[model samples]
Target: MDRIDGGGTMSLHFGVFEVYGPQVGGTLSWPHPLSDSIDFADSQHWVDIAQIMDRTGYDFLFFADGFGYPILGDDIALGAVERGINFSGYDPAGLVPILMRETTGLGFVITANTGVDHPVQLARRFSTLDAISNGRFGWNVVTGSSQNAVAELFGHTEMVPHDVRYAIAAEYVELAKKYWEESWSDDALVADPVRGIYADRTGITRVTYDGEHYRSDGYFGAPPTRQRTPVIFQAGTSPAGRAFAATHAECVFVQATVPAHTARNVAHIREVAAEQGREDPRIMSGLTVVVAETSQEAHRLAAEFDAMQTDDVVATLYAGNTGIDLLALDPERTLHQVLEAGGPVGQMGTSNIERFLGSNGAPAPTVREIIDDLKGKGTRGFRIVGDPHKVADGIEALAAETGLDGFLIEPVFGTRDIAAFGELVLPILRERGRLADRVDGETLRERMRR
Candidate 1:
């Protein structure tokens, strides 16, 4: 099958996978002197980044968010706050309209939990956002990973099982889709001042759902936006997650450590999507790029960034991600030994461990080594440390090797690295025919599909 476009060029889409928090992806990035993390709380900070990407030819700026903080308890939570380790940020949903107004062509993807939000409210909110962005909007659907924290916040006593959360999300999305795609016909809205009728009421229908996990019955308030259902994105790599993405997500994010592994995942999702009658699920792997005018300088910058990852910060963020306490465990013990001894782990933690094992070819890594990997290139996709040419070459090679649709660039020093990438690598890619020309006023869905 031909992967290239009709022009026979490698037109790869690019987006930044962001968190609205102190750090984007790398933990404890706020304290770095070169980082623009100081203004994370300011709306202008986000606006600046969006404008930069918009001018640089990025397809979208994705905001990965959640309502629950990873840490619990006062003392540990205080420590997390003092270190600024993914502990602070505004809701990306609220920031969408503000950003869309500021940028011309850059798309905005906001992460929203299907398990927690009511289907009706979620549908309406996305519809409004899509309209406000003039179709430059997407939703990153997640099934509430921070189960304990999320459950506590929502006043639920029992934690929803991992697979069960996927089930709930499936139903939740189905109901929301009905609201987005079925509630209103193409000609529902009509500004007929002559007949004193604003909308053809006969063309509108009530949307209702009574599933095992959710219930919603309502006349959808918002009319259909440019893209009636905003582009759906999912970022889970587990079996249940892959199934969910295959079934619904228009774009998928994977954080494999190697190209071969990423290729396997991409192929699997495409196959599943094909079986489900949804062809060509767009898959993007997480990538962290560090580039400078010289290879030596880029390596020096990468090393400096690595040096800032303190043990406490690494452990704090790692524990938050996998539910495994690196500090409490014996550093010398192999990961194999820890898991074999029945280590305490949740669904996310187990998945991370398994990915680590698969990448290393064995679980012989010490707990400390594993911790270091997590702080470095563990889950973050193929790291490129070089000049602009080297970065572009690596990206092109990886795309050819893995059959990935695109990449979600992970920031090393927040906006500093993102800006650096824009200034250095983007031009090289544009010249190499790896990026498509930006079409102004195109909807997010159109840009993604193109």
Candidate 2:
């Protein structure tokens, strides 16, 4: 394959568990027993998975989170729950500590929104976790996109406007940085044995900052962790989102209906990041992988998986995400007007909605077209089905064309999908010299830089 760097050499960074926890069960909605049966409740299982991923040289296992169920017709979130969707799983954060203890070098990236917790609390929690994990921690910063969550849990009457939420997130991350980076100096942790002191108090500095959304007036309580501040990950494609990510994110997750669209967004983020003083921000796109011994078998498996995704589940998910109930709109009605009108809720403002609805004045895609697009045949980040070599080729192609740093491999099944990737695709990447060799207990930052 041709390389973007023109050196006939390339590196492929792979991450897993972007939505629900891979495509093992053939849906992203509720009643996700397929994923649950993999033993999220078992601490040993989490550790084994972490160890396996690290040994295979997988970059990280990212947990995609949501605060509340979808806001469709019923309060039940039936479409998601009944179908074993993405929302059926438990919060991955609760499992991170165990996983951290299980593996030596694997990075743990968790999604925590600025809307849910205060900066002081967030700073303390991440700092403690970083220390516990010995610097193998990253945060996927988000200003929540669930209107139902804001109203029900946070006591907000409505979700904040898109731009305004980004504004808040900017300040939120700034506060976290101040706590993580500015509060403690390298000399702070003396750990002098004869002196019977663990830390030199004088080396710790207090940070005082006044901002529109948040303010702080204290030194970080915990001592410095491996990386003072965990690496920041952001996922949003709005103009404001891009600007915010450009200023703060080290890694950005992107999703688009097609490869061209993914490439366009990658370019946009790079430009914005450069403008904000970051020369490059690692871009990771969402992808699904299905692999078998032969190309034909892969196709047959993919077809069976596609057949399992009922229209009700897909439509319900689409409606909840866009805030325009597809059930209310005529199935045959063009989504043009809805796109023009936007959503009733502020948090539902996503750039992908237009692409899904064909609001950019392109030919509107049918529900099947949308689903097929999600399957990744014509789409950018989604990887529908392929044998080991085919899957590797698709990943390499995407990175070369879009200048992306890597991909977040959303699984098609439970642990088996991830296990299959480790067994099949990883070896191909390794033979091609596109994958990293096992490192000896490196920090997350060092690993990322490598």
- Please give the clash total of every predicted structure, in order: 0, 20
The global C-alpha lDDT for each of the candidates, from Candidate 1 onward, is: 0.81, 0.70
Looking at model 1, report the run of 10 residues with the lowest lDDT sum: 70-79
Give the Cα error of residue 164 in candidate 2, in Å: 1.2
User: Which candidate achieves the best TM-score against the true structure?
Assistant: 1
Write down the RMSD of all candidates, one decimal each: 2.2, 3.5
**Tens digits of lDDT, candidate 1, 1-450:** 344665688689899988877776636666678888667788999898999999888999998888765554323444467877656788888887999999899999999998776888888889999999899999999987556566677899866777888998999999999999999999999979999998998989987788898887779989999999999999988888888999999999976666787788889999999998886877898889988899999999899888777777776666556656677778888666656767545455446766655354554578878777777543366789999999999998999899898899988887888898988999998887777777878999888877
Candidate 1 all-Cα RMSD: 2.2
| Candidate 2, residue 91: lDDT | 71
Q: TM-score of the candidate numbered 1?
A: 0.94
